[model samples]
Target: MALTNPAFSTNPAFKENGQAQTAATLSAENLQQMYEAPSATSVQTDRMTVEDTIVKTAICFAFLLAGAVVGWIVPALALPAALVGFVLALVNIFKKKPSAPLILAYSAVQGVFVGGISFVFEAQWQSIVIQAVIGTLAVVGVTLALFASGKIRASKKATKIFLIAMFGYLAYSLVNVILMWTGVTGGTFGLSSDVRIFGIPLGVVIGIVVVLLGAYSLVLDFDAIKQGVANRAPRIYGWSGAFGIMVTVIWLYLEILRLLAIARD
Candidate 1:
């Protein structure tokens, strides 16, 4: 499911007249020369670019990894980290402007949740964390390559389907959590485990579908980034793109981890 970050589209920099208008009297030759000028680096102009977005994403991941290491060493912090991360995520998502500190903070806290939960799952599954990590990376790598190659693109119809599926998944997840908490379901995965289709756990199917949804979400992220860069959005918005990507990747990893665990069981 795609977590829409308003910072990408709601910002004024992307709107008409947000940027300075070019001089109308400028000659065609002058305009051509200006267009041919060296591409603006992040430091050169406050405009967005693919490179800046990459750096922002790398920074977020670095903070995430650092926090993950701390969380892995102290597994008891998982739930608390998750709660805090959730609140921070909401704040970042709803904030009018993208704040680097808040985005980084969210990444760090989410890392703690990821690491602690991974450790807990690894303790029982023996190497499942590594598997999930590799799986997540593989999926991301392939999706990126496909997108960069222009072999895949997001379409309005597909996005509509994706949103519908995401809503259905959210509903299912809510009910499953309720069942688990109320002691109505007798398995670790609640309805996902209790229900079977063709002798396979329902989670396996749901997990695969969720993973596909996550993949499409990545495509949307890429599309958003492309639009941002093309529109010469403010560099600060790159952090918003990075934040969206990190959230999607984390969701992808968790879903893959759960799917693997269910399969192993």
Candidate 2:
């Protein structure tokens, strides 16, 4: 039961052989200690677990929050941070093994980018950052609740559609960016603002759709983590789960932020 998310799919740690690999490296003394131990936790056994993954995710977010505070104070670092974040994200995603330091670096860099952008948005629209935060939290909370209740799930058919939509959205976004850079479109959001569908700004509609995609991405992240746990992946692989969730949540937040900005305009 492999997941679609590149973070999990490309990593061999989520495979059934993950635990065997860990065991192979253990010394006789370590095995004896484990056998003599009254009870061993997931950490003691060096196996992936949901609780450990949650803790790792929290630690990553904490670093992100700290970096965001710095970015909020100095928004000029936004562009550089974004560039660094993108590179780090690519590195973390394709790396054969999960690296906590690299993942944390990516999260921190992305936080700076997020904070810098939020500050810029807030300058034009008062309190927009807080509104975006609330909206993001609401969406995440509801999505998590539904997923926990088994009301929502990731399926092959839905994931295939998601990938298709992702490609289309990327293409549209690239075109929009080029138009804005070349001065072909005018406004803060380029085509999203200049174009209108049924008297509604094109950005507003696209934002809603993209937000849904982001939400689905979250579902995929959650499913991937669940698979990793079930597979008894190495404890270190928990960082991969955290990284995946962070990526999706940041994406979701940005989409919601842009959507709100377009609506306000």
Candidate 3:
């Protein structure tokens, strides 16, 4: 139930041959024309399709799956793979121009990281890995359904709340890690075990909330893709879309894994 990698904007008509564009070069009249939408601003991207996202995501996942197999066979690559993936993730994020090869390679490295981690966790919890996988699929499926039915959407208010929640969660995670590292807590799972609300672990609650956030992220991704199409953005933004989906899926899987671990514990 992973989200498909998003496709690039299909607006080849407005492209500047993969080169960057700016107002300093375009004439006043050209700029004026560029500002105007080809049709009504309110027009929806009904014509655009989500199929490409699926295809591209499948490709990324294929590479990931392949990397996982390799990871299981060669445990030594796990640490290096994770480090490489982290660096690649940063590089991809800061790069103004999307490089397809580099992005795909990043996916491969991430595959090894994910596979190795999953292997370790699954070994510890036995069937819990399966449970987490099912949970991830269920969450992703339900979110997509809600979105397709127009029951869920990304609004400014929700986005604002999401940002605040993410920041708070990050801060809490940092504090929790510090607590664990400083030997202030004797819990096995850090804040996940030490902090419980009404007998329920904090991590479980946080996981559910974060799952919703990831789903909303999908909505935002959709909105961005639609806007890109309308804006006649360059084709490479497809890589951007793919990268975005990868990020969301990774986050979702990690959250699911944590939730399952807490449940098993």
Candidate 4:
């Protein structure tokens, strides 16, 4: 017969001698009313929610766009921005708790890198930026639609595969960079551009696979957000969701841009 409602259990009115007062004296009607009362909402409880996460994500993107403008105007800052952003990304990923300022800062720096790279690519291939943007949007839109429709879902097995693929891609990228720096390969994209398979550039084939991996990574991000909401996580954690989405989307866009550039070559 003790007060069972969490909202009232801690109230002094419901406590007697530092212990919860038994509701034995209360009428059955009162107990029924209390039981039937509406529960607290996510906002009232300060919990994570889909709408809040979306708003946070949008804010991060706004910062990104603003930084991108500066990067476009001064392409020289691209390399430095990329290095700083990478460090920030690692910090954010490894930190136990989410920090809004750090996450937003990472977004801004990443935007600079994105803008600088886009400018470089555009200078070489006219309209390629638009093409990459369209391609990225298409992939994101389709992936989101599939997720919302329950056609795509994250599974342990698939995530394991994704991690393996990501590691492989990273290793290959590192080797390619080394080769480029050492002048082992002449093309802009190193092996990706220099090698060919059945008259098709190796980059085109690898790019297609990487694009699919990026899409699946998006799926994982969506699933994580959904889980966070379901678990009623703290509201501040929404920034983590925003950060994850931004990282995935930016990676996806850059991959698409590179793919288009290689294909055009």
Candidate 5:
């Protein structure tokens, strides 16, 4: 959000675990006097720390869950909640300083949108929401685990591939929506049910691709947080990092649910 985290800006090796890359003048030892430490300017940043990002992300999700629950129960409040959430997202992205209250408010509204949509989707899909929730958790958990274990890391080539896949999926969705709107088919699915690539359902194909995109998005989000912490950005900006991650996760969950439903129907 800050045109990439400061760690990325300052350090070439920002992607790896986001640990501080710059050499510290004073080690955690008695070799150097604490009082005569060099100025902050002398300290260079290399990457954002993971611990702080986790803490901030946890706080942000709490707010998101609260908002989602409210929105789920109050049908009439859904649209307004989405509007409010959008505004807050923009504010968080643009504001130089993060406000905890504002970020929490955003979470509330986003939660409402999630809940309301979940309610509608569940009504049609029947227990599909649970499946989606579980799937979402699985993906996030797996991704995080792999990342922590150094099994998966973001790369420029992979990122370019992700973007290409995303564009292809979006185009397919647009065409499908158009076909459905024109009453070309009177069924639950559009191109999803009819189209097949290599004997697999088109929807399934697209879903997998999109899910991958969402997963990669998490990588980027984590990278940003890692960068932020490395740069020792204002603690408040931690909220910004949290919000970004939350948004990506939610999107990922929704997409997973939708894909699963497509499979079921």
Candidate 6:
């Protein structure tokens, strides 16, 4: 079988053998129990399943929340946390196979950066963090529901548009960052604050666009998980799906927080 999915392609469990395994022989009664098994599970067989993915995602989230609490208490760690998290994100993306330790580490480090930045934003604008959290959850819930209902899907055309928009947004961000570093704009948000279109802060516009991209990213993640399950991917591959979802959700939350801050400004 052709292993196209990156997660499964690197896994050895999916490899097939022409010769049958010579394990301990089973009798007819043992075979009968096999047919009578209650249900298939990740532990029972190395195949992927929705329940396994959910469990993996929950574990990652637990580590993330724990790390967030630590970072919340020490807001000064935000900068370093962001730097480390970026490096880890790149590492995880390029890895041939999923590593539970690495994925969990990424989640914890990212959570630190998220918590620290959230604390900073909350200090500047009261109640902004709560609002952003709610907005993030709402977007994720709606996107998941739409996907589950078959109202939304990943298509080549929409994916092309998403890539184009992502590139444009990246270019704008690079320019904005350079301008700010050189002290060209003195405002808190640099170009986003100084530039206005239709009496709205440019950041608000960009933030809205990025938020939409993040939501679509979640949809893509869901699609990937669905495909993996259908393809009978290795159970461990669920971590990849969980990691992708966490990254997109974090991006969405940050964008929502920025948009709310700009609006309140």
TM-score of each: 0.90, 0.88, 0.78, 0.85, 0.77, 0.90
Runs off by more than 4 Å, candidate 5 = 1-49
lDDT of 3 by residue, 1-265 (tens): 1222223333343344576787899998998998884853222533333455456667887887798788866767889998999899888877866677888898888888877878888788897667777877787788778877879777778888878898988998899899999999777678887789999988888878888887788777766665655555555566666777777787788788887887667
Best by lDDT: 1
The residue ranges of model 3 lying beyond 4 angstroms of the native Cα positions read: 1-49
**Considering summed lDDT, which 10 consecutive residues are worst modelled in model 3?**
1-10
lDDT of 5 by residue, 85-110 (tens): 88988887666556778877787778
Clashing pairs in 1: none
Per-residue alpha-carbon lDDT of candidate 1 for residues 175-243, written as tens digits (9 for 90 to 100): 999999999999889989889999999999999999999999999999888888877788899998999
Off by over 4 Å in 6: 1-5, 9-35
lDDT of 6 by residue, 19-136 (tens): 8654358778887897898986698887778889889999998988888887899988889999999999889888978888999999999889888998999999999999999999
- Where is model 1 poorest over a 10-residue stretch in terms of lDDT? 1-10
State model 3's lDDT: 0.74
lDDT, candidate 4, 14-116, per-residue tens: 2224566679978999999989999776678777788898999999999999888888899899999999999999999877678999999999999999999
lDDT of 6 at 215: 85
lDDT (0 to 1) per candidate? 0.91, 0.88, 0.74, 0.86, 0.74, 0.86
For model 3 the local lDDT of residue 193 reads: 76
Model 2 lDDT per residue over 146-226, tens place: 999999999888888989999999999999999999999988899999999999999999999998998888898888888
